[model samples]
Target: MRALTYHGAKDLRIDTVPDPVIEQPDDIVLRVTATAICGSDLHIYRGKIPMVDDGDVLGHEFMGVVEEVGAGVRDIRKGDRVVVPFTISCGECFFCRLQQYACCETTNDGRGAILNRKAITPPAALFGYSGLYGGVPGGQAELVRVPKANVGPLVVPGSLGDEQVLFLSDILPTGYQAALNAEVGEGSTVAIFGAGPVGMMAAACCRMLGAERILMVDQYRYRLDFAVQAYGVEEINFEECDDPAELIIERTGYRGVDASIEAVGFEAKGSVTETVLTAAKLEGSSGKALRQCIAATRRGGMVSVAGVYAGFIHAFMFGDAFDKGLTFRMGQTHVQRYMVELLQFIEDGRLVPDAIISHRMKLADAPRGYEIFEEKQEDCRKVVLTP
Candidate 1:
């Protein structure tokens, strides 16, 4: 089988690899139908996260058809269409019960390896990543071995397509979680940083949650354009505005946004932007966006961060959050928790997540897809690779 492998920073390739098989009674082997690239995958491409390295298959957002199942996997069978959660949880763990599957003890952080097992050392172990998570092979291939499939839901709804349900694995649920964390409510005003795929999806969820006004911010014109044209959202070009927060406040008549969702993650800005401390903060535009989110948030409002972050940050001021009594909720989206609700939305025709998909290609062209998404070329929102 040909799989997309990560070979350090800004390097990737399509390589022939052994096909994945069901290794345990609870496991299942999936013939991947469609897989999408995620923003977290960019961390490995930039070599910022823990264990990214060459030869690691690096995709987590995927939907597929079951080719085989382990003996204990009764709910799912060969030929079932499914979407595997990015976080592979054992279902019986404490975190799984709490709907925090990302933190499950048996969860594999993109690496298919079960927790507590030993494998050859790699950069990170995320599905296609190399740092902290085990560098297990990912679904951006012809076939993938899913460690726990029974717990992972398969969408059998008659109305949904693979494109719409594919996002249920990661971004759709993630965006829903972001809106939930933001506490979007009836007539509430919300501001979301980064109009990327996740950010846009969050806006859609926010609208569904009854937010009266949704402020979508991004430096890129095309993305913000998509936000407004697709969802009837208000766009804010950070580049054009002298202060996004001030503009948002003006738009809301001096009451800042009721909630803010920071979807740019580590690209969030630092508390202070001095030359010496700039490098000490997060790597990308997220750091800058975080600063804007804090400034834009209304007093006592919530800030939900769903973007990826690594390690610590410099010049971070907890003082602002404390003074304003801001509620901060940020972490990996517990995708398993919201899968059902998101799928139902798809079934009801209220949400169409596939609108964010900008590019599609065969698994062999996975590297090119990564390049296009990384460079943000040609209004690329999400890239899907078919095996």
Candidate 2:
């Protein structure tokens, strides 16, 4: 099988590897049809996440057909079209019962190593993610072994295209969760930092949930402009303003935005030197976007973070957030919990997830796809690869 593997910083290759076979009674082997690179994947690509090893398969956002199933996998079978959640979870756990699939206790085998390094318990195992989670082989290959088959793979009707249901694996629920965490509703004013795909979805979701006004902030004019045009949200290029928080203040008539979303994680627009230093293991990740989120959010506003940050963020304004009584919500999305409702949103003609896709290529061209996506070249917002 051909799949993209991580070699090092800024290096990925489509390598031929062994085909997958069923490993557990509840397991399924999926013939992956479509897979997409995620913004979080850049953390591994940049060597900032320290979770992957050389030759680890790279990819988490994908959908496929069930090629085979284990003996205990009764609800799933061969030829079933499904979108597998990136977070591999056993549905019978206590956390799973609470709809907290990301924190499932039984899924991750990498928690010891993760806690040894970070001093915090790890989340559920993630496909194609680094050893810091589970070192599970990702879905960006010809076939993948899927665990917890009964719980994680959400079956989609055959009529819906892969593009429509694929984002439901992660970013769709992530964006919707961001909005829900912010507690945005009718007549609420919101500001979002980072105009990437998750930010775009957050904007769209905010409007769908009845936000009265939406403001998008980003350093790139192209992204800001893209979000503005796509969602009818006001845009601000941070480079254009002396202080972006003041723009939020002025835009919301001095009250600040009612809520804010942090969609730029480790790749946040901060000092290039510091980001490089951090990536090189010289310092910590910068909290440039989080600072901006706190600065732009109104007093008592909710700050919802959908971005991926692994370690301590330097210069985080905890005091400011505390002083302002701001509510902060941050975590990986519990994807399966939100999939059904969000899938309905798409099936009802409310969302076109593929709008974020700017490039599509064969799985053999995955290396190039990663390059374009990581470099943000060719106005690329998203990249989808077919295997």
Every model's TM-score: 0.91, 0.95
Which pairs, if any, clash in model 2?
A: none
Q: How much is the lDDT of residue 76 in candidate 2?
A: 82
lDDT tens digits by residue: candidate 1, 171-197: 888899999999998998999988888
Compared with the true structure, the alpha-carbon lDDT of candidate 1 equals 0.79
Question: 1-387 in candidate 2: lDDT tens per residue?
Answer: 988999999888989899988888999999999999898888788777666888899899999999999999978879999999899888888889999999887888786223235555567899998887889999889999999998999899877999988999888899999999999899999988888888988988998899999988887777777887788898888888767878898878888999999988866667776677676766456788888889889898999989887555677879999988999998888998999998899999887777888899999998888889877799989999999
Per-residue error for 257 in candidate 1, Å, reads: 0.6
The per-candidate count of clashes, in order, stands at 25, 0
In angstroms, how far off is 59's CA in candidate 1? 0.2
Q: Which regions of candidate 2 are displaced past 4 Å?
A: 112-121, 272-283
